[model samples]
Every structure is written in structure tokens, then in C-alpha cells.
Target: MGGLRRAALVLVLPAALLLSGCVATPQEGITNSSSPSELIPAPASGAPTTSAPLETAQTSNKAPVYWIGRSNDNAFLYREFRDVPDQDNPVTRALRVMMSQTPLDPDFFTPWQNPKKLATSISGENVITVDVSADAFNSNVDAAMAERAIQQLVYTATAAAASAGLIDSGQQVQVVILVDGHTDYVAFNHVRLGAPTSRSAGLVAPVWIIDPQEGDSVGDGSVKISGRSTAQGGKLHWEILKVDADNAKTAYLNGTTTASTNAVQPGLFTLSANLGPGRYEVRVSQVDASDSAKELFQDTRGFTVK
Candidate 1:
């Protein structure tokens, strides 16, 4: 993103939310409040257009929603494909669920409170406009977490738009958040809103388990596990741990495998193991460069085999 400069709201809707009367100023030394709307600058010259209906845009019944989760003792975004209501606008549907529903994985959660009203629309410039009620910004957080929370919306909105084919994948996608159609509101008492936000680099988990989502069940015998990593498809260490009735874990399997560097999604890896009926955990990690024996950016999933 380029240096901070004021951006004019080019598109205007007939009915918009009332502007917030409260005013907030960013505290000095807080870099998170800086604006980066240029990352998804408005197109040179194009009238903003709304997204097509679900019948024309949606590729599947599922919408991808990103949630905030802890990994390696730090917060990062994790995604899950959730079923969407038929005929509903995919982008707004996903955003509503993201703010209101509990994540399938216990480790993932959203700081947002469900707004009274929510809506989304895409522009010819590839910017997604998310007009959510002011109630959604009720959660209190620090500057760093607040920044991440806003990015959480950025990631979810863009993802939803992409999954529904509302925007072109080849072009950069950004999200412009408006509370009830008004801008310049402070979010969570930290980050300011109304800026065209893009996904902040390095805010996603380096490694995340995509299958057997936390607390899943599978059939006995051969079980397949897979995940995505950003380690440049380098060697990854994997292990399976069997949990006994006493809830103690016993090492079941361990090995080293390389993620597919050429995968369309990048760093995609898969492995399978044979096991009798039991509860088990699959963990994957890369060796810490400074300490080969220590694991770095580890991600794990628990599942039961019937």
C-alpha cells in the first residue's frame, strides 16, 4: 500500500446509514491506524456495479469464511467452507454467518457481534463494499488485535466474493467497510473504518489443517489427512498420536514429507495412515532453522475413528 492520502467515495447509494456522531482520534505512535486504501485503489474510470445474483455468481453451495484463531501463540486467520442458504447473496450470507455463528473448530472465533443489518456489493473496480450495522463493532480490543479483526473482515469479504465469482480472481480484491453506509468510524475503539482494506501480509496462519476439522470423526482403517502450508513447500515433519481411554497420547506414527510446491493453492500436502478404532491427533510442523529438533508454526487436528 502507498502512503496515506484521502480517498473520495466515488460511488453513492440512495439510502445509506446515518453518519456516526461520535469522533475518535488515533493515538500517537499507533501505526495500525494508518490508512492503506490505495492497495485497492478505485479503477481509472468505471461506474460501480453490484454483484450478480447467486444463480449467476455462486460456484457452489458453500461459502468460505475466515475466523481468528491462535497458532504458535499468535493470532492468525483460518478458513472454513460453510453451507450457505439457497438463493441468498453469497457475500452477505457468508459475512452474516461469520459474525453470528460459532466456528466449527473450537479454536476459531469471531470478535464481531452480529449486526442488525448487513449487506455487500462489488464494484467495477474490484472493491467489495460491506455495509454492516454499527452494533458489529462492539467488541473491545487493542490496536494490534483490532487491526487483525478488521483484516479478518477483509479476508472474509474478499474470500466470499471470490468463492461466489463476484470478482475477477486475476485482479487485486479489496474491501471497503461502511457502518450503516457511513464512513470514518472507529472500530473496536482502535482501528478506524471506511478505508478500502486489503489483506495484511503475514496475517494468515503459516500452516493450517484443512481436513478432519477439529473434533471430526472418520471410519476405521486408512485415514487421510491434509493441510496447506506457506513454508515454500519445504520438508514438513508429521506425527499421529493415539489417545487412550485415560486421555493420554501415545506416539502412533511419525515421518517427514514434502509439500507440493507446484500446487495451485501452494504448499498443499497430504498423507494417510492406517489405524484401528480410536481417537487420534495429526500434527504437522516445519523444523525451526535455529533448532532442527524444535517444531515451528505447528498446526494440529483431533479426530475419532469409528
Candidate 2:
């Protein structure tokens, strides 16, 4: 590969995990379904909450939920922060929503069924125990899709934990899944449960729309589209398409943007547009090196300009 393409790959993909340095172990008997639920160690009871109280409390109720979506003809995970009702159990509530609730993005979907019961607890070692009923595996999936589904759970669980401050984000976090308190059970008849699983590599969308999420409304007609994408040769393509009453789409604007190759937030890119009141779709894609006119990987989101 050439130097530019190589750099693009490094910026686009997540850093590889160095598991050799990790020495944490899962606590035995804590995997039982009846184990008391404790979302990691919190401040001792009756601590002062006056410092940034409103921001802290509001964040406590928000959970980062991951959903499976198609991109580049394959399945990958996408994320959205949802306001869950159960503030005390962010991880568990996020898992329940992942299995039972529909994703806010229409392009995303979940194959897991609503389990009769779901629970989560994080150990001091950063290992999350998720004990769920067997009914969650009701949906059938092939080996490949099933693996993504399991990762869908892994990503959601880990994100929730990190967001809720249940685990230190700097440390390596893993998830141990259990179906009805049993280990080594095959999930969706494909992937085996019970082992500590970390977020899998290459499961994230190469290009995604972060701001103005699907179905969002831009009240002032000033829209800002931002996302992360692999910039082949430092170039990415974006376009805004207007949707007509009959569902026909007409290209309204298009341009090329450069992705950041810096150490912080590599592949991050953003653009802005002003439009009249109407529905529109914003698309971001990486140009195919082999074919200039073709797109290698693309992501899109639909919203309204009110």
C-alpha cells in the first residue's frame, strides 16, 4: 500500500488492544443471576453533590446505546445516547432497551428479543457481568450477523458502563454474558457466552453522521453535519439531498472535506449548509481509490430543516 492509503487505514481503524498488560480476573459467584446489583463503586453514601449537581444528575440518566446497522454491505455498530427511565441501572437499562426498544435511527436494527429479565454488575477488575433470561436469543441469525449482534451487546454494555462512571475509561473493560445464570451457552446458536469479551475491532462504521442525528430538526435552517470517516488521500465527499413529497431525492449540494489525521479524534470531519424549510438527507462517504467515481464506504442521516 502507498503511504497515503496506509495513513488513512491507521486513522480510520481503532487502536489494537494490548491484552498482555491486562491481568484482571472475574470474581466467582458474582456471575449468579441473584447477585446483588451494584454499578461499580460510587461515592460513599451522603457525599456532597453540590459541585456540578445538575450536570452530574442529568448525565447519570443518559446511557450510550449501540445498535447494529448496515454499511459497506456489512454489519457494524452505531451509537446514540438515550435517556433511560431507570437511572440507577444504566447498563442494565441500556441492555434492556437494546434488546426490546427500536433504535432512533431508522437504518439501525436489533435482532435480540426482549428477555423476561436482565441485570448487570461491574467488578473491581472492570469485568461486567450481564445475566439475562434465555428469551433474549429468540431471533435467528447467521454466524457472521450473530457475532456482530454479540458485539452489539458488548459495545452497548461497555459504553454504558464508561458513560455512567461504573468503570474507569482508561482501563480495559470486558463483558461476561450469562443466559439464566448458566455459562458456555451458545447465544443465537452461534457465539458462545461466559467468556470475558471486549469490543471487537472493525465493528464501527467507517463513516457516520454524528450531529443532527436521524429525524432531528434544525429549527433555523442552518444545518451542521459532522462525522468521522476515512479520508483516502486526505479527501472525503459529502452531499445534501432534498426529499420531495413523493419520496424522490434531488441533489441540493455536494463538496469534499478533509479528515483530521491528528492524534486526537482522527478522521473527524464536519461541514455546514443553509437551506429552506424541507426534509433532507446528509451523506458522507470515502472515495474509492480504485474508482474515483465510486464510494468505498458511506453513511447517511435524514432530518428536517424547519
Q: Report the C-alpha displacement of residue 63, candidate 1, in angstroms.
A: 1.9
- Residues 83-190 of candidate 1 have per-residue lDDT tens digits of 877544667878888999999888788899999989777666777788889999888776767777888788888877776666777777767688777777678876
lDDT of 2 by residue, 263-286 (tens): 455666789898899999888877
Best by TM-score: 1
Cα lDDT for residue 160, model 2? 72
Model 1 poorest 10 in a row by lDDT? 1-10
Every candidate's lDDT: 0.70, 0.67
Candidate 2, residue 30: the lDDT equals 27
